[model samples]
Structures are given as C-alpha cells and as structure tokens.
Target: MELIRAIQLLKLNAVSTAWVDAVWDCEFTDAEPLDSTVEDEIKEDVKVFKKVYKQLLGFSKEDSTQSVWNVFGENCVSVKSLVAVLACFVLGAKAKSSSVEQRRHSLQAAAVYLLLLRIPGSVANKVFHQILFDSCLDIVLKCWPQSAGKKRKKETLKSSQGDGKSGKRPKPPKKVSEEMVIDEEDDEEEEEEVYFSAQDLLGMREDVCSLIQTLLKLLENFSLRDKPQSADSCVRLFTELTNLEPLVGELSFSEKRDVDKLQSLPELAYHGLWLLCSSSNHGEGNECRRRVFFTDCCTLFLMMRKERAKPCLLPPSQAVCNARDQAILFISQIVDEQTEATLPLLKILIQHICHQIVEKSEYRASGAQAVGRLVTKMPCQNYADFVKWLFNYSLNTRVAFRMFALDVAMVLLAQEEREADATLEPDLASYLSHRFLVRSVVYGRRSDVSPTVRAHAMHCLAQCLELPSHNATKWIHELFSSSSTAGSQTMMETGHSEQTLKRGETAQKTALTFRTIELTKHKSLAVTTRRSTDELPLAAA
Candidate 1:
C-alpha cells in the first residue's frame, strides 16, 4: 500500500506540473506572433502534458483510498488536488487564448475528469463531488456564448452611429448622462470578457456537445444525486442547457456536423430528466425533495417546448421527435398515477403551469390542457381547495391569465357534472352548490375588459349553470337585467352622451348591486361560499 500510494502521488504531481507548463507555454506563445521555434516548443510541452495525463488516467483507475486520505485527511493539506486540476482545465477552456485547439484540449481534459469522478468510490466526500459538478457545469454554461447575435448587432449599430457623428461636435454635460454612460461601459466590459474569437466559435458547437454527453454519462453515478446540493445543481444545469439555442443564426451556418451535434441535445436533455424522475422515486418519503424534482421536471418540459417553438433552419431529427413524445408521455403517466404521495407533485405542476399561463407563453394552450387534465385527476378531498385557489387566480389583473383561469374553471365544472352522482362527496357537492361561485363567473362575463376574456367567462358561466346541482340561472338573469337597467339609467341621467358613461363602468356598478341583492336575498348563498371570501376584495377592486 505504501509503495502504490507513493507511485500515485508522484504521478499526480507530474500531471499537475505538466499542465501548468503547458498552460504557461500557450499563454506566452499566444502573446507574440507564433514563430516556428515558439510553436515547436509549445507543441513539445503539449505532448508532455498529454503523456502525463494518460498515465494519470490509467494508474488512477483503482481506488487510492490511502493516498487520498494522506493528501486530504486531517493534519494534511485540505485542498482537493484532483478537483483543483479539474478546475484548471475548466478555466483553460474559457481562457482568452485565440487557439481553438488549445480550448478543445482543455474541454477534452475536463471531460476526462468527469469520467474519473464517475469511477465508483473514487470520490467519497460529497463536498468534493459538489465541487466537481460545479466545475463541469461552469464549463458548459460559460462556453455557450448566449445571445451573441444580438450583442454583435447592437455593437454594429453603435459603430455606425459613432461613424455618422464623427464630424459633429457631441455635447454631453449632464451628470446623470455621465453616470449612465459609466454604467453602460462597465456592463459592456463585463460582456466583452466572455466574448470568444471567430476561431473558437467555429468549433464550440462540437466541443459543447461532447462535454454535455460526457456529463450525462457521469450523471449515472449515485454520488452526484446522494446529496441534495449536488443533485439540485445537476438539475439546474440540465434545465439551463435545455433553454440554450441549438443554432444561433450568426454563430453557425447550419452545417451537417453542427446539425448532428445539435440533434443530440433534446434527446440528452430528455434522458437527464428521466434519470432525475427515476431517482426521485427512491426518496418517496422526502416530500420536499420530490416537490422540487417535479417542479424541475415541469420546467424542463416547458423549456423543451420553448426550444421547439424556435424556428430552426434544419429540420428536427428523429431523436428530437422521439424525445419530445417520450417526455410528454412521461408527464402524462405522472398525472395519471394520482395517489396520496403524488398529490404534492401535482400541485407543483399546477403552480408551474399557472406561471406559464401568466407569462402568456406560446405553449400555454397545451399547458392549459395539462392543467385541465391534472385537475380532473385530483383527489375529491383536494378538489375544493384547488377550485378555491383557481377562483382567486382568475381574479388576476392580466387578461390572458384570467381567461386561462376561466378555461380551467370550465373544465372543473364539466368534470363535476360528469362525476356527480348519489354518492357525491360532501366537499365537492358544497363547492358546486355555491351560488356566489357561479355568480362570480357571471360577473367576469359582464365586467371583464377584453372580449376574449368575457367570452371565456361566458362559457365558464354556461358550464356552471349546466351543473345539475347549481341553480344559478335566476341569479345570472337578475344580474344581467340589473346591469342593463343600470346602463340605461346612467345614459338617461347623463342625457344620452357617450362620454358620460364608459363601456364597463355601468357593468361594474351593476355587479356590485347584484352582489348586495344576492347576499341580502339569500343568506344561504353566503354560507355556502366557504373559502371563496378571499377573492371578494380582489373582485371588488
């Protein structure tokens, strides 16, 4: 054991020294124009680096428990030597060197570190594993060059404006303008630090794809998921990668190689999501963890949808289609398998779907259908709580979200109508029998600003009135009649001037009046309106 440990430690030191010499040679050679002599020296150093790296790879395959303890144990150095080397490679990949080959080599080395980390019992400490995960993720994220096209376009515009004003005397005297300019320059400097050369950009697509593929393979290791922090980072990395643009217009010309590399992204992302979901099953008792897992899953689905919505120059590969279908099928299965354990997962899904609706994403229609499907599968005992929440959500100021809420409410009412029987649960029966709830739908139809919202509210009201247990027709009729009477009364009072009464004002006043009358006329309606009182203030506002 002593002999083997000494051999491993010597090999570790050699690898570190070789890597530093290689980086030093590249940095100095890049500073001056590359001459034959300098280029030969740099190549020689790179060869030495590769030779030692290979030896490290081969000899370090076995568990070096005693050696690792000697270096990282108490009364010794606390720094993680292996992880430090990995960080160096990551930094090398993002270095300011103009050599594409150098960056590629660094990326390849970092990927090797990932594989080494995958070796069973190679890294026992969870904290070191977390550090390795962060390094891998950092390389993946920092190399992508997001929004490059927009930045270049903005720069071009600035250059043109500057050239056009070259002959003019520019006057700038305001302190506020000077401060703004200083802030803008600071932002531009920050952005410029990450800007890659044209050479680097040419091969970045293949390099990034290779790194991600290796990382995905590494994810199979149990240590990455054993700790919550590392697991969360892994999840976040996958989510962000999914959101990346597969093909930037200015970056690549959509070559066959680029297309092939980009093709694997969606599929790999799907695999990552599947692994995460399956792993969450092992922790069934950990509700908070499972909730986070489900939330990330839903977010991943949304991001994939957003990616699909982007107009691509090349046709989507079969893998992309297969991955998307499989993801959808997986989400559907989760929704179908409703149980006490999965109820929290379903709630998380609902919350994310609601966020999609609020953002008015192009994928929101499908999300709305998902919401309806999820609500239908909810347990009877939780249905009332969900409905109450949905009612409050519909009162949001955003027209699109309000319309979405109305659509969901229609689905719920339809489900209740379909499921209502002699053995109906008391909570759901009480929910359906609430006249104020039905009248709120009526209020939306009459008072909402957007015609689409009003139309949806009308449909929701129709669904509500269609319920067998709901006797809201008389109330809706009185509400509409009162609204019309108020409108006419206002017009008459104001001498029939169009300016005297705006479009929705009379309807709002009439809604208030009808609410008062209904409350006064039927105290039972108010009693049945359990848990919905929270929305009244919002509605009034």
Candidate 2:
C-alpha cells in the first residue's frame, strides 16, 4: 500500500525537478545480497508501476479529456519517459544482482522490453540506441579490469627513469625453500588462469553485440522509408560507441588494474562499423540528414584516427577500415556536385587519400581512385590545391607513391583536353610553366630506378605533350634539349672509359630509357593514365 501511494504521489507531482528525481531514484532495492522476500517485494513494486504505466497509455487514448491528459502529462507519463524509467529499473536490477546469470537475465529483460515490444520506433530507437546503449557500454567498460591508468603511470615512471641517473643493480636474493617455490608457482598459475578466462570481457561482448545487432535490425526496418533521421540516429550511436578515448578518459584507466590483460579487449568498434555504414546508406534521402550524416562520419573517422595513434600491437580493426572505405564511397556518390557544404567532406577525403597512399593500406588503391574522381568534381580552387599536392608528392617521394600521385596528376591535367569546358583555377593555371613540367618529367624518366615508375613518368610526359596549353610546345622543346644533353654527356663518358664494352652497354640502355614523346594528331588526347593495371604499349596512339 505504501509503494502504491508513493507511486501516486510521484504521478501527482507537477514540477520536472520533483518528478524526474523521484522517478530516477525509484530503484527496486538498495540492499546488497537481496533475499528472496526482498526480491519478491521489489518485483511486486515494479509490477505495480508497469500496470499503472499501461493504464495511463490506454486511458489517455480512450479518454480524450484535456484535464486527464494534462494531469498525466504533468507526471511525464510519455513513452520516452516510461522507457527511460524501465531502462533504469533493468540496469538497477542487473547491478544489484550477485549472480552472473541473474545479471545477464536482467539485461536480456531490458533488451526484450525496449526492443521486442511493439512500441513506436521513434520512442524505441531513442531509448534502445541512445539510452540503453550508453548504459550497456558503461556496464561493459566497468567489466574491464581497471588497469589502463596503472599501465599509463607505469609507463610514465619507466620514461621518467631514463631521465634520471641509472641506479645500481640490486644484489641477487638467496634461494627459497621448495615449499615456498611451489606456493609462488601456484599463485602465478592462479593469476594466469584468471587472466586467460576473461569472463567479464566475454560476457560484456556477447551482451553488447546482441543489443547492437538488434538495433541494426530496427534500423533496417526503417530503411527504404523517408526515415533519414532514423539512419542518422543509427550512425550517431555507432560514432559514439566505437570511440574508446572518451570512455577511457571518463573511466580513468590510468588508475586501475581491473583489466586483466591490456590486449584482451573485445572487438567493440569492429562490430559497430558495418552497421553504421549500411544504415547510413539506407537513410540519406533527406538533404539535411545527408549533410549531418557526412559531418558525423568525418568526426567518427577523426576519432578512429586518434585511436590508431595509441600504441597497440594488434592490427587495425578491419571494420574500422571498412567503415572508412564506405564513408569515402558514400561521400563520393552523394556529393555529386561540389558545394560549400561538401568542402569539409572533400578535405577529409583528400586527407585520407594522402594518408592511405603513404601508409599503404589494402584500400589505398580504392582511396586513390576515389580522390581521382573527387578531383574532377572539386571546386576550381580546391582542384588547384589538389594539383599542387600531387606535384609536391611526385617531386618529394621518389617511390611507388610518387608514381601513383603522378598518375592522378595525369588525369587531372588531361581533364582540360578531355573536356573543353574544364578550366584551370588561377593557382594551377599560373604554375603550368614549361620548365616545371619539363623538370618533373625529366627526373622521373631518367633518374628513377624503378622501371615501373619510369614507365608511369613516360605516360605522364606523353599526356603533358598532348596538352593544348601554350606551354605544351615549349615543354616539348625543353624535353628534347634535356634528353640530347643527357645523351651527349653519356656518350662522352662512355667513349673515355677504359671498360668501353660495359660503358657502351650502359649508355645504350640509358638511351632506350629516355622520355620518348611522339606527337600524333588524334581527335582528343585519350590518355590511359591508369598505371594500377597491366603495362601498356609505349606508343602514344
């Protein structure tokens, strides 16, 4: 009777402060090691609240009396409020339970109630993806042995030790008895057993993965509809979940040793990435939602980028890489036209392309291709910057990356010839000098050690020769002069050398490797700048 009266009093409260606090504090029981009788009492109280909540929903529909609605509304008897309260209830139940099975069952109950019920998706999604996810993540993070902080402190201590003078080695200890040795061995084995079991991390992974899968199903159900916001919500949840830094900071991993081993963490972000991308693809119909989705994904990529900087032995999560790939592909398809809204998107894509090119990820080729497509669509000013970036890369790194950068540059520079409407930005236009073009090509074709790079450099030179700019003819003259000068120098050196046979053979090979630009008139310069595939015939058709 007192429990029912207390529930009624909370319902009657009008102020947000009064009711929110009252309901939030309405846990089943505060006592630990709850007895059967206490559990039964708490369950009874929960049942009464559930019953009243249903009645309010039912009566509010049938009884359209404004007075009744106003009274119930004051008590905040909406679906969201109800879901929040029930989530609190389930979390409290799980926390208060001593048995692992009981806690799991409590969490399952929370999932079933929030997800399996025929509640409106808006209400259910908000609670399941946001509130429940956060609560579950908190639970999982707690399950981790709190050793991140201690590990950090240990690292700092080790680092600080290097700065101070080295201390003398301690004397060797005397041998202990066989019984003491056995006792120490037993303790070491016990610690190893606990570390290997990893029950907490396993249990947390199972529960969280289950919930994430359920949320993904809910997202799919809303896909193909005009639920752009729904898609946004799904992506937003993942963006928060996959990020570990904020969670680490909040949990203070620096101070604790709860995590048994540093490497024993579950693949939390890996599972969330695919879902985020697939769901976002389904929900990008609304313009506003699409923009927000892109922005949030960029943020998520940055967060993952930060995560990579932390020292870990494991390879990157495949899911993180896949998610980034999907984001690039998505941005490429959706942002068909360059606008102010997409400037940030283009910047991030370019950044990723540059990093991927240098890092040599499996997706580097795809990232480069995406950047290639983006360059053609970029605003004139941005395109100019991209051209300069490619130029810099080609000149700086004399490696395969430089080859790829030159290939991309070939496509960009040839865009003017391929499409008459294509115009160069002032930055790129002013820098298209005969000397700059000639110098870049001459170094690549003659100086680069790799045959493949030399081939690509030749292809780029061919494309440049076909360009219709005023400097094209001048570039041709300069290339011929440089090639002649190199050939003459090689002849003089070869003639004067004692080993004339070896020197003659080397000079012959050098002559064959020189930049061969054949000017043939075609309708337009259809230069095949793709060096990622099989080798092409050298003759410029």
Candidate 3:
C-alpha cells in the first residue's frame, strides 16, 4: 500500500533517478512454479505492479483527470524512468530462471500497461513505446514453442556439455560393468524424453496467446498518423509473428485441445495485419510509404500460409480459411478504391499466388480465386500485363499450374465479356486474338500429360474460340488437320503392331477421336466441309 502511495506521489512530483532505482530495488518476487498449489508472495507482487501500472497511466477509479504526461511531459526523463521500470519487469519474465507462472504475471502487468497506453493523451514518447514493444515481443517469442526436434537438439547439446568444464572426460575402461551399461541406456532414454508434457505445452500456448492479444490491441490503438515509426515497428512485429510455427509432430490424443489454441495464433497475427492495412490513411504524398506498408502486409500474409503448410498434425482449420478470405477481401477493397496506387502491390500478390500454383500448395485454388478477384477490379490498361502473364503460364511446363493459369485466364476473359462497356487496349486485343495463344490452348487440350490438365485446357479452348473477335477458321482448320494426321498415324501404328497396342493406348485414341469430333461440331465455326468418319479414307475394320 505504501508503495502504491509513493507511485501516486511520483505522478505529482518530478520523477528522478533515485526514485526509479528505489522502485526497481523493491522486493518483487518472481512468479511461482506451475505445479505449486499455493501462490503467496508472487500474487502480492503482481497486485502491487498492477496498481503501480494503473497509477502511472493515470487510470484511477476515483480520479480520472490525472495523466502520466501531465506530470513530466511526454519526453521528460521521469517518463523514461517509469517506462524503464515496467520494461525491466517485462524483460525479466523471459529469463531462463523464471517459471511459467512468473512469466504469465509479468506479461499480465505488461498487458495492463499497454492497455492503458491506449487512452488518449497518454505517453507518446518514442523511447517509452520502443522499450515496451521490444520487451513484450521478446517475451512472447521466447514463450512460443519451437519445433520439437529443435528443442530436443538444444536440450541434448546442453546435456552433453559436462558441467561447462573445458577438459575432456576420462576414457572408460575396456570392460565396463553391467551397472555402467544400464546407466548409459538410461541416459539415452532420458534424452529421448525431452519433449514438453501436456501441462507445460498448454501453459506455454496460453502465455503466447495472452501476450499476442495484448500486442494486437496495442497495434490497433496505435496512431499511424502521428507514430509512423511505431507503425513500422508493429508491422515488423506481426511479420515475425506470422513466421512462428507450431511444434513439429503429430498431435497426440492428449494434445487435441491445443489445436484451436495453436490455430488462434496465426488468425490473430493475420487480423493484426488486416487491421493495419484497413486503417491506413492513404493521403497525397504518402504513396511510397503506403506501398511499403501494403507490400509488407502482403509478404506477411504469404509467410503465414507458408508456415501453416509445414509438417504438423493440425488440420486445415476454419479459422485459417476465414483469415485467408479476410485478407483477400481487404486487398480487393484496397484495389477497388485505389487501383492505380495499389497496382504494384497487386502484382506482388499475384506473383506469390503464381508461386503457390507452381508449388502445388493446398491454397493454390484460393490463390487463383484471389487473382481473379483482383484482376476484375483492375483497370483495362492493366489487363494487358496480367493477361500476358496468364497466357505465358497457361503453357507452363508444370501441368498443375498450367491448368490453374488456364482457368484464371478463362475467368478473366469471361469477366471481360460480361462487362459490356469494358475496352481493351489495341495491343492487348491483337495479342489475345493472335494464333500463339490458340495454339497453346490447343496443344494443352490435345497432348497434355495429365487428364485434368487436358480437361481444363479443353474448357479454356472453348472460351477462347467463343470470343467474337477471334477468327476460328484458321484454328478450326488446324484442329481438323491435326486430328486427321493423328488419326492416320494411330492407324499406321496399329497396323504395324496390332498385337502390341496397349488397351490404355487404344482407349486414349478413341477418346481423342471423339473430342476432335465434338470440337468440329462447335457452333462458332462456319465450316461447310464437314466429313463423316467413314468418308475420311480410313480402312474399314
């Protein structure tokens, strides 16, 4: 109680180094162990710190007018001193000697401090913000569990180091005792059991979630207009958070409760980024800064997806899908509002999507949908570049991405056709009508390695052939001629080795012949020389 009174007095009087040192030297015990049944001294220390934190922020139940900056101003040495005291406790929570419970209390105190900092007219000093941000981020990262193999390796290395002594150990005798052999086997068993228990893992995840929630709240309240530097720092924090992965292993039956908890980490980090992007004020002369911010946001989004793809037992959760949709919606909204300014960021996002498609990531379908949405929002002039990119990838060597790019191109074309007023640049128009794209689609449909790719290519070819400006006469002729040549070639091969022809090959020939006949009957073609199969000069069976 006396300590609380001293903090209140400091609010009125000018704070000095002596008072700061006294506060730091106060007997605040570390948190108790997790398994302890009773918490006595640590609980009192936590309450005292919470009271002091409220006092420093001028958050009072009785007197609400008092403010921290009112006493020492925003940049005074006294404010820095007070901030340092709180930051010290926050950092101390990350110490190796600190138990999980101690870390939790320290983080709770930090959260209170950050929460109060959100009040208007609170301390805006850069030093004060940096100190708290760094401390909180450090503690959160340390508390987040890393890969199991990494943790085991670290423990094993520590165990191997013999009491930190530099000298080599004496060699064992040639004939070891039976007891010695048993002890060695027991040591191996102990090393193998280095993983965290269910209780410890649960506690660590709770701490991470709590601290991340606090940091996210702080970020939401951060005034980007006045604190650009702080905004950058928050961006960095979320970027790092997105890269954090869960423990690497299959979730045992005991650890199922952790699935949702672990899933919440990425969702929270994603929401923080979404908040940053949505709340940014894109005024005149800030285009460069806006670009950097949006780029970082996009990069962080991709990084979270990458981290989620790592080997873990956590199935693809709904939280992840919702987060992804939210991100796409956010980007789409920005592009819709400032298409010109956000074009570069859009390109970056599309590039990442293309990368995902190439890698056959599980999120590739969503990525393709994102591309389609963003492209629909883009201006006509910008369509040429994206069209060119899609066409190039439609013929990609990777069959899956080739199919994906073809689908995206088909969607873009369909959208353009639906928008009656949309105009394409002359260069793009000519390029789209050229024979190269037709040939690429035709090749994919006829000779692609995968059946799925071939099917997608067939659909995309139909869309291309339906374009009003496209002259299907040449492509139709080429398709029929190629079909004829392929048919004649198949007949010769069958005649040369009728017994060697595989059943799969024969079925493929039949399917290909039917697909060719279907294309020839497409209504868009005005050919008059349609020939029946019996009149095409093939030998009768």
RMSD of each: 12.9, 17.5, 17.7
lDDT digits (tens) for residues 276-378 of candidate 1: 5544432334332342334344343343312212211112344343333344444555445436555655665565456344334334444565676666666
lDDT of 2 at 377: 59
Query: What is the Å distance of residue 280 in model 1 from its true position?
Result: 5.5
User: Over the stretch 1-541, how does candidate 3's per-residue lDDT look in tens digits?
Assistant: 3334644432323334654555444422232222222224235453555555445444422356655455445334255455544554566656444666666666755665575465555555433454455556556655554455545745866675565365778443356333112111122223222345789767666656665665555555555555444555555556456445432322222211322243455555555655565555411233223433343333322333122122121223554445445556556665665566566556644644553443333445555666777766666556565666555445444466666766565545444332212576666654444343455434434445567766766766666667653344355455558656885455434333223223455434433432322223221111211210101111110
Which ten-residue region of model 2 has the weakest summed lDDT? 522-531
| Candidate 2 off by > 4 Å | 1-85, 89-133, 136-236, 239-325, 355-358, 361-363, 379-381, 393-427, 430-541
Q: Order the numbered candidates by lDDT, best leading.
A: 3, 1, 2
Clash pairs, candidate 1, are: none
Best by TM-score: 1
Residue 190, model 1: Cα distance from true site in angstroms:
7.0
Error of 1 at 324 (Å): 9.1
Off by over 4 Å in 3: 1-43, 53-64, 70-78, 95-98, 112-132, 144-233, 236-271, 278-320, 337-340, 361-363, 395-404, 410-416, 420-424, 429-541
Cand. 1 Cα-lDDT:
0.47
lDDT of 2: 0.41
Q: Any residue pairs clashing in model 3, and if so which?
A: 31-102
